[model samples]
Target chain A: MALGEVFLIPTVLQDDETALESLPINIINTVRNCQVIFTENERTTRRHLKKMDRNIVIDNFQWFTIGKIEDSILDTFSQQLQLGKNVAIVSEAGCPGIADPGQFLIAEAQKINAKIHPLVGPSSILLALMASGMNGQNFHFMGYLPVDTTERKNAIRKIESMSINDNCTFIFIETPYRNVPLVKDIISNTKPSTRLCIAANITAASENIRTKSIQDWKKEDLNYLHKQPTIFLLDGGRQYAPKSHY
Target chain B: MALGEVFLIPTVLQDDETALESLPINIINTVRNCQVIFTENERTTRRHLKKMDRNIVIDNFQWFTIGKIEDSILDTFSQQLQLGKNVAIVSEAGCPGIADPGQFLIAEAQKINAKIHPLVGPSSILLALMASGMNGQNFHFMGYLPVDTTERKNAIRKIESMSINDNCTFIFIETPYRNVPLVKDIISNTKPSTRLCIAANITAASENIRTKSIQDWKKEDLNYLHKQPTIFLLDGGRQYAPKSHY
Candidate 1:
């Protein structure tokens, strides 16, 4: 049981029924059987659960830990799983492998072959790109940027270059406050003609989808402040090649 | 009212109740709220409605022509909408924007502010990318390729170069039988190390999601002669740049 320190569970964005239903019945079943459950924020999960009010046995658990990578917290989940006891891994929202803490636990789960399965659901990132009619086939998902100023700016430059140089849709997330500066960097750094699709407050009422060439942006576009959740989709301006036929 | 013509409605590739419920409401409230609905195959929609056991009001107009565009069908839908009567546009399957008749209507709609609102749902292309864990932020969905050899080879070149030059995922779909040869061209024509992720039988029991470097593919990899639905995801091998700040 390689100290099944952690097990992965998924929480979807919004209260989207589609995303909730997309979870493999097996994973949910497993969670129901688990002895303990760990969430980034147990209080939020408990409140959300109470509202949904489904008859599930998984609700009661010896809940524990600070949300982010607390070393002792990892030990608690890991030791239980390793001992062949079931443990649940929950993100505040969305799929696990995405730009979230679940990745580390997932990698560990993969290394152990601990019966892992990624249940599919509504990814705000994917939803935005699909509707934007930009490149939905090939695009990078470089989770979140580093906290350091230089590294963060460098990551943005790399993304801008990738968008212009190869015509790839470069995607990244910014902490709420960084939204203004990030948008500014994009405006000042990338080619004026680059196509930008910003999906802000996705899956929520404030949900908005705006797309345009960089040069076309007016000051109003920058007014996307005070909004906490946002996903940026940049069109890599590579020339289009005809699709290959038989 | 503008002369409304019959419309082609592809089966949307999702099974979410809220989304389906929201579609008519969204289209009627926002997009052209017209008096009629035309489809390539209303029989299927009727069957779907029966399966869901919902009493949907579908007014019968005329059968839509498949494979060829009918001018008369276009006239009826276009005219009614133009005359300030709202018209509804749908497909027999999936979203209209990807490789379908909807593009023609959508382009026309955009030109006239006939208002196009593409709702979010399960797209085979996006689903494939999501499962592959490859690039999702930037990708080029080059619909279907032209079938001529010289032109197709040229198209492959464009796909290959984009991967190497920009690192965007190149997504393509082929008739079930042609996937093997397409893989051969990608392997022979591009760098041997390019990564390829092909997801066949997506969202179904016989689903196959396989990833292999170009050089690692064996005769076995090309052995599938599946008569199943497929979406091919390929990594054209774009070089990652040295870190830079945006």
Candidate 2:
């Protein structure tokens, strides 16, 4: 039998109605056609699927909650594929296999020569970079920062230096509650002239994305971003002159 | 007057009916509301906007073809924003400010503190990475490789080494015509076990995305990739065991 195809589906970054607008209409068809689903959070995935289509019978398909890529999970996944069952992997938010545990299943699927389809959707990382006005030609997405203060500060310094030397944009995210501390570390460790972009609550009514130099950012009250999902972008090179009169 | 908002609009990666399905419905409202448009190619942008909504009066908006970021263009862009006239930037394909010159305008927008909105749309780079089954937690997007053969080979080797050392997937694109030669160089310069993914004609009926080891890829003919838009991903570390029987 031919190997079953694997679909990498994307979900909304925010829980609001506007957040769902970011998803493509065709995602509904793909979701309905799948026989098995591997998701980061089963409850949230089921809710999102229902929101996408009211007619979908949630219990008709098999579901697996992805905690860790255990051997038993891979065994079931591979066996399903061999049985010619179309499988889908959904992340809590954004695209699968990106800063999520879905890549392990995708890697296994690739080994078995299963066709993989990645549907388009909202990605906070990609959206942040596009709006940052930084050099998009070369960029690095570092999943998260070190938890320790000193190590994170050192990481910030290294990232700033790399940006300066390579003319590349460095993108990193932090856990919601740690957003403020990370911003503080970024401001203190980097040069005053270096550019930093803070994108919070993306794809939602409260979305705020702004780019400013570290010196300028120091004057603002960033308490608003304390617990909001945020993406930080740093660019130490390619400074622009202040706006000139026409 | 309040600074006008700048919208970064994404266009279809492939010129096909199914490709348009990837775009969000909200984009239509944003496009219709804009008073000015900065696009990579005015002709293609007009055609795309027309396709998005046939009822749109294309000539109502002031159009600017972005050839280069000239001082004159920035002057006009700033003036419009200062006047509180919302403007939009559209690329020939995919998201603006990514592998395109839209960043220059965005940089100016940031300098002046204009609100920038990046709408959700198809992005080949993000899509290719999602399906490559490579490490996406940390990755570097190096826009394009060197055009010179020897330099290109050296570049490929460096990319592979970086992937192995950093455990990061490296993504880069080639001009359609150079796809075959770049693949040849990648296969010849990298280790047999190193994995490479070729994603060509993404989002089109002819879409092809596959990941395989260097040795395995060498046995197949790759001429079909010639003259097709393609994304190449290299992952030299993190090899998985061959699928085990249940």
Model 1 segments more than 4 A misplaced: A1-10, A15-53, A59-91, A100-120, A133-172, A184-195, A212-216, A219-221, A234-246, B1-50, B60-92, B96-120, B133-172, B184-196, B210-222, B234-246
Model 2 residue runs over 4 Å out of place are A240-246, B240-246
Cα lDDT, model 2, residue A193: 91
- For model 1 the TM-score comes to 0.62
* lDDT tens readout by residue for model 1, B1-246: 443322222343444442243122222222233355444456775565444434444444223332344555445556656766544455565555455554444334433435333444445765566555455545566666657767878888787787777666778888767766776666776667676766766544445565566776654556574555677767765422213200
True contacts kept of each: 0.06, 0.71
* Among all candidates shown, the one with the greatest TM-score: 2
Candidate 2's residue-wise lDDT over B109-227, tens digit each? 98898989999999899999999889888999999999999999999999999999988899999999999989999999999999999999888877888999999999999999989
Tell me the TM-score for chain B of model 1.
0.73
Best by DockQ: 2
DockQ scores of the candidates: 0.11, 0.56
